[model samples]
Target chain A: MIEILLSFSQATGIYSFMNSPWGWPVAESIHFFGLCLLVGTVGLFDLRMMGFAKEISLADLHRLVPAGVAGYSLNVVTGIMFLSTAPDQYIYNPAVQSKFFFMLIAGINMVFFYATTANEVKSGDAISRVLFRAKAIAAISLACWCAVIICGRLITYYRPPYHWCLWC
Target chain B: MPGSKLGLLKLETLARLEETALSTWMRESGFAFFSALTVHSLAMAFVVGINFAIALRLVGFAPRLEIAALSRFYSLHWYAAVFIFISGMALLLAYPAKALTNPVFYLKLAALTLGLLISRHFQATFFDRPKVTNDRRTINLAYVSVLLWVVTLTAGRFLAYTHNTLLASRYF
Candidate 1:
């Protein structure tokens, strides 16, 4: 897996750019900027559903989801850049593993929301059960994303023993 | 005081801060230092995220969305802002010289302060008027606010790199 990622990165020139003097920090900055965008948009949408800011229409706020999608795309690109640049440093890191785990949960939560509660929740007032489900989904999504952010920070700040896996 | 003399005086004070129990503990204890750093990042993301949303709105992303109602998110924004302050002060206390002596740190401070002041301006205007519409001035302010936030985030990232002195007490 590491070889494949490195080969792909080298083939795509991402490795060279990331190895350059300013490349890593630049990518890190953009990676974070993308996250802020996601939090601002999709995260805000979640807050709306979870009964925080009750003023904005759900359908209207959904207009900003495209921007959140765009932000997620940016993070994926930069994330790939980082992963492919140094697979060895990241792949074994438990913090990175935890970060990926949170992202996976968030992804599943999003698809589930869109598949199940999205329509009912977005169409103004919904049945009580649907509202409850939507709130649960929103809370899960927010928690997952927050956990992802914490894991990302931990990747830089701490490198635990036997970091190849979390339980070890 | 002479310029070099003043510089030395500042360094002397910073060195004293570095030797303090709290600062020493924060630096030595990974849990304390990294927890503060993580909270700082979390708070920064929320604050910047909310600001970006507001800026996008004012720049005409959601044309019909009520600006006043949207400003309700300001409640969350300010709460996150307070976390930024507490975490930020903790970070600064840990390494007083690392941030204080850096010019980039000052740039970040200026940008963040101006960006937040713009947040206040938006919240005040939108809440006061029932049907406030975006004008040329408002749109321009939105653009400026966006730019200021960009500078603030970028400068924050660069602060790690641009610091000339990591610990002032080393020289003292």
Candidate 2:
């Protein structure tokens, strides 16, 4: 099934992007820039909630959230381009699998923040508590993202066999 | 082993440690080593980038907030940096020979050191003094810190292109 999908992708000339001399590098550069902008904006907001930049009210700090969201959006779009170009190669790869799983956990972590912490943030009295949860989420996000990058790098080394080969 | 043998072993180690894309490409250890390197670079952007941004705000360039409120951001920055360091160490272990011998790696270490030192100074000098807002010195330092981090990151990427051994030798 995985091979069939990969062949279809290949037949479509999807992976041809890798053939371009500048394609991979350009994608990688953009990916990195997105990471910086994402961290910068979200991190600023988190710092505000934590009382590091206490002068800035939550409402003011909240402005930076959109920038972070934009960064995330860039990553999502570019990330898809990377994965689509090589389906089986990534789907069966262990490192990619691990990265995807961790990313899901990170996503869920964000959901918890939105579901539970969002109200506390609006209430205004719980800046300290909100800060704690925000920090936790930020930290986890960073870790999972790091894992994702590592796994992505490992794709070459952990190239999936076209078929499962059992050995003892 | 005698002095000559000791020298030979050290030479061999240096040769092995040389940073070359081909060496990285052809390393026999399988996926673990390379994966760690990719993770390290990714983690670096987050940790360093976030830290620099917060420091800039605290220094007064982004004057919208009181310097003290950025603490949460700083804490997250530190955590991200630490994660990168741990994973970075794992990467280093996988290719101790190459990393230790590579000049570019040394450059990265130096840049990180200098960057961190400036960050510490900014934290102590400006951040501690709540009254000190919009100081020119702080802003200047913030600019320098950001530049240093960019250099560090770029140098890290260029390691694939610049390492002497990659061009000089081939890996099988």
Candidate 3:
């Protein structure tokens, strides 16, 4: 996995750019900006479903979700830059592993929401306080994203992580 | 004193601040420093995120979203803003000279202040009004708010790379 990612970066010039002094911090800035965008949009939608900002129409708020998708795309691009550029450092780190785990949960939760609850919640079509399921999904989604952020911070502190990491 | 001397004097004071029991604990304790940094990031995301959402609306993304109702999120934004300051202060306490001696830190402070002021203006103007209109000036302010926030984030990231004095206590 590391070899393939390195080769891809080398071919794409991502290796050269990321190796530069400014590259890492620049990427960090963009990564954070993207996160804020996601939190502001998709997270806001989640909050509304959880019943904050009750006056705002769910369908109207749904429009901002595209911006959230855009933010998520930015994060993925920058994330690959970080991961591919230094696979050894991140791949073996337990914090990075936990971050990925939360991201996966958030992703799955999003899919499940759209599949089961989005339509009724958005259109107000037969919506109920039994939209309890929707609220639960929203809470889980928010918690997962928050957990992901915390884990991202922990990665810096846990360098060359200890033996608890099975591969480490 | 000349400008350079005054600057040096300020840094000397900050260096002593870093040596205090509280500052020492904040810097040396992994849990303390780590908590401050993490809370700062979390609060920042919410504050910046909410600001971005409002700016987008002003520039016409969600045309039907009543700007009045949208400003309600400002309550959350304000709450997060307070955390940003509290966490920010803890971070500065941890590395007094590191932040105070760096010009980039001041730039971030300035940009963030301006961004919040813009948010305050928007909230005060639109929140109570049943009808809201984004005039040309208001739209321009929104654009400027976005730029200010980008500057704040960039300047913040650059602080780690650009600081020339990590511990002014060397001279102290």
| C-alpha local distance difference test of each model | 0.87, 0.63, 0.88
Q: Pick the candidate with the highest TM-score.
A: 3
Per-residue lDDT value at A11 in model 3: 90
What is the alpha-carbon lDDT for the whole of candidate 3?
Answer: 0.88
Q: Which residues of candidate 2, in runs, are more than 4 Å off?
A: A1-23, A40-61, A84-88, A91-94, A101-116, A126-157, A162-168, B1-13, B16-46, B55-63, B71-107, B161-172
lDDT of 3 at B133: 86
Residue range B102-145, candidate 2, lDDT tens digits: 78888877887788777666656645455766567666777888
Better of 1 and 3 by DockQ: 3
* Least well predicted 10-residue stretch by lDDT in candidate 1 chain A: A159-168
CAPRI verdict (incorrect, acceptable, medium, high) for model 2: acceptable
User: Which regions in candidate 3 have their CA more than 4 angstroms from the true location?
Assistant: A161-163, B1-4, B168-172
The fnat of each candidate, in order, is 0.71, 0.49, 0.79
Query: Which 10 residues in a row give candidate 2 chain B its minimum summed lDDT?
Result: B163-172
lDDT string, candidate 2, A1-168, tens digits: 555655654776645764566555556655665667666776555544544655557665655566567767877766765677666566777767777787798788778878988667745776675668866765776566656666556666666674332220
Q: Between candidates 1 and 3, which one is better according to lDDT?
A: 3
Task: Please identify which of the two predictions, 1 or 3, would achieve the higher TM-score against the true structure.
Answer: 3
